[model samples]
Target: MEQLHQQSILFAVGINHKTAPVEIREQIFVHEDEIPALLTELRKTLVEAVVLSTCNRTEIYGVTTRTDLDLDFYKDLLINFKGAETFVSREHFFASVSCAACQQLFQVATSLDSKIVGDTQILGQLRDAYAVAKRHEATGKILNQLHQRAFKIGKQARTETRLHKGAVSISLAAVELAAEIFGSLTGKTVLVIGAGETARMTAECLIQRRVGKILITNRTRSNADELLESLKKSNNFAGETIALNELKNHLNEADIIISSTSSPAPVLEKTDFDRQTNKILLIDIAVPRDIAPEVAECKNVLLKNIDDLHSIVDRNSRRRMADLPLVKRIIMKEMSNFLVWYYSLPLLPTVLQCGAKPDKEIQSEIVRVKEFLLANVSHVHKLAMQNGAENFAGHVEVVNTLVAMKNAALTLRLEIEA
Candidate 1:
């Protein structure tokens, strides 16, 4: 009975934004080129496997003929990739089985469980993840169909909901707010502080809106210059890297200042301004507050904090939430269909036995009918002329019954073959 329980088991394990921070998540991150090796490694332990590594999550999905290895067993596989420097171990690595795992992947592909709900990138990421598994022959029929259906359902969610439509990230929300104030960013000179991921994304957003000029500044001049060069290459950005010391001289030139730096204290203070009094819009996205609180006290300064971006995030989330019911309905429908297919696997031998008996029974009946027809052939032909329509009707009905039986036999054979 213990070995019998191994049949048709599906499970998943790993860490995501909900469970781990960027530091911990990065350790398990698998590059596209690394997937084949990982697939080969996982399949050694589990019969079927797929690895989905994205910016916000890293998960290993598996199917095995062993219920003996629990979720922790799979989670340990991910930890084996790299050392556990920042991981909280059990707190960060969550494991799920069967239907729960299936639901998790579907929700992820649809962007329902993304860091920023309704992010448009998860679908493409999921497709890439599944493609790697398929190319390596890592996934069997069950997982192949599961991922394909996940893609289909993700598309259905997009069509049925407005969730993926608006500014999702803090960077995007800040950009959208800028656009609303300035009408158009085509000729605006935006000042960006720091060269971190958030600041890079924010600058990209500004460039996307056709911001006229972008000025980047950082404590280390070399880092600022390097970041500007990278951004320039990416989008052919017409931007300049300013020396941090020149912040005061150039402060008046910027229409908007968005800062996200890892600083212990406020980078932009009231003292940094005052002398250069131009109407300035400040967006501080740093954790310790990059812009000085007193900067907002300046008559010409309009300030917004990182926390303020929540309003936009909430709005976008609500848009996606409105369609949650429809998305869930499709997921449940697909789940039921797959569940029926999964449950039928255990009855394979019984189905085969039941299927063959019908064929023999039908063949025997066909043989009896053929003998009767052959014996009455001449008598039936003469009666057809003597009795006319009544005799002809009787012969036609017998032949029709024979045809029906043959068709039924053919259909049953086809089903068994399938």
Candidate 2:
């Protein structure tokens, strides 16, 4: 029975905005360059793995054959791998297995489980994570199917629901906060620090608010120039690229400062803003934070970090709650579809064993069984697509037949092996 249970178990483990603060999340944050090595290390224990790390969360989705592996096992692996055992602990991590894992990932990919619900960026991030895993050959059949379906379900959620109807991202939330503070942004000078997607989105939002002047600065001047150029084509805003070294020179001129740089440390310290006498609103959306915590102590300076946006996020999340049921329905349906396919996987080997092929021919028999399983999955998927919600009963009947076949195959293989 233990040998029979050796089929791949889909699982997920990690810390997110819900489980840990930005400081702890950043400590375990996995950069794109770090993913390949991490996947290599995880492959020692997992049959397949995908690492999805963003400013708000760092999650590992994996498949393992070992039944002994549990939530704490992955928690310890993450703590040691990220060298974060010093401050982080198992309590800060959350784990899910099998169907729960699939449900968690589906929610994440659809932005239902984000720090801010309806965040449009998480889907792209999920896609990128899966791409990296696939490119590095880190994914096998289980992860490949799971992630592919996750992407599709993510798209379906967005298209079918109004979850993303309002200000749906951290960048937009930051801009909304700035608008609330300043009342009117018509002539407000905004300084944008960083050339990443968040920074670009902030600048665009500022432009939409008719901000008078925008100063963009980045570590790489050319990237800032590129952003400025892109913004110029879209909006007729007064925007200029400033050198990062000269940031302090114009710091006092801006009414609002939005920083989303990927710096490992604070780019703006207390001393940098101490000399400023004018009122300024600074929003730091980066995990490691581009602005130091002490900067909030400076007179007339209002500093808001990622966590500060929770109130705004909560309000917007409530507004989007009406669409939640539809999105969850989509998730539940897809999860059922995925589990049906997943539960059938173990039967492939069972059917192969029942064949009683010679050792030399076993490998070929395994391939044949794999193709058969894939065909059945494909057929089921086709039926679900063609039938839609109204024919869910019919789909379940098809699923029941597949499950019966799997059981019969398992019984035959078990008897032969016994």
Candidate 3:
């Protein structure tokens, strides 16, 4: 028979913290309900794929024969979803196939190159995304196996390396820095400029710090109100919602400002900061920067970017480094397990058919032989022979068939080029 093989191709089109702001990222975030239809639209041409949309990143992973499908077309589709203004230059984008896709996926899964290093949530999110794609039959042999293996590698990195041990999430670092600047959050007024996941995370962290008051603001008043209502559930938080237009007026009133909006440029500019009367500790977690670095020049206005958090996170990163070996061991073990299943995929049906067909043939032959022996042998000799030769020969035929198939598979594999 002619060889049957499939190649995996991965094409990702989206922006991340490195390429776009939170506003841009959020704009591109694919709603869960929209996935099936989106996949349906893409499936007409893409063959099989997975869509991974989160507050931090929106990526597409697929396997297809149409490797030449215009990336601009997909990028245009994303721009329609995310708004074209959010994208900077096209240079920030990436596209790869086979080994390259495999590498990129491994890095993402490990959180090696995430906005927050070693963020564990991403691994689970990736797994869930894969499951959804698989459930919808949107992933084929290539991506199915590659993604599964990448996921295992991610788990291995976490278990084998101290990369994630005591990881300093951006939110936690912002809270810690807030404490250093303001001494305590008990009497401080905090405003979260966006109501997305990062915004919610910042707000939650502030609430945990026992911040005296919290305010939620978003371009969408309903979103701000939604987040505010959620925060009100906590007994300690007593806060209000401010309209996006009202942000500047209350800027002076906030003791701590954490901005995670999806703006293309600085939302809180130098003009927005009032150096006097307000000691605003601004933690900008958004990419493309929500609060301009120049704003930090204002007296009593302490602003920090993502990289600044790395120093503290780095120390914690070192402590967790001790666990890397164990994590690696786990990942290696899982990878081996996954590979066994993966490699066997192509051979499984053939192997099963080989065994099954032989079993049937042997049974038929045994029945024929039994009838012939019954007719030919003496009645006294027939009983023992029926229990021995017929049964043993049938079982032997089945075993021999399996061994022969396995040997054939092994020989075929050895003959194939590495």
lDDT of each: 0.71, 0.81, 0.65
Q: Best candidate per lDDT, number? A: 2
lDDT for 8 in candidate 3 is 25
Query: Pairing residues by index, what is the TM-score of model 3?
Result: 0.64
Order of quality (TM-score):
2, 3, 1
What is the C-alpha lDDT profile of model 2 across 1-418, one tens digit per residue?
A: 2234245677788899999998888888886777898999999888899999899999999887775555577788888988988989988988766666788899998898998989989999899999999998989888899988899988987787888877368899999888888888899999999999888888888888999999999999999999999999978989999999999999889999999988878889999987897999999999778898899999989999889887788889999999899999898888877866675565455644344554656666555545545556655444444442122233334445555655566589779999
- Candidate 1, 232-255: lDDT as tens digits: 887966789888878778999998
lDDT at residue 399 of model 1 (Cα atoms): 34
Q: Top TM-score: which candidate number? A: 2
What local lDDT does model 1 show for residue 182?
74
TM-score of candidate 2 to 2 decimals: 0.84
Q: Give the Å error, residue 85, model 3.
A: 11
Alpha-carbon shift of residue 44 in model 1 (angstroms): 1.1
Better candidate by TM-score, 1 or 2: 2
Error of 2 at 262 (Å): 1.1
Ranking by lDDT: 2, 1, 3
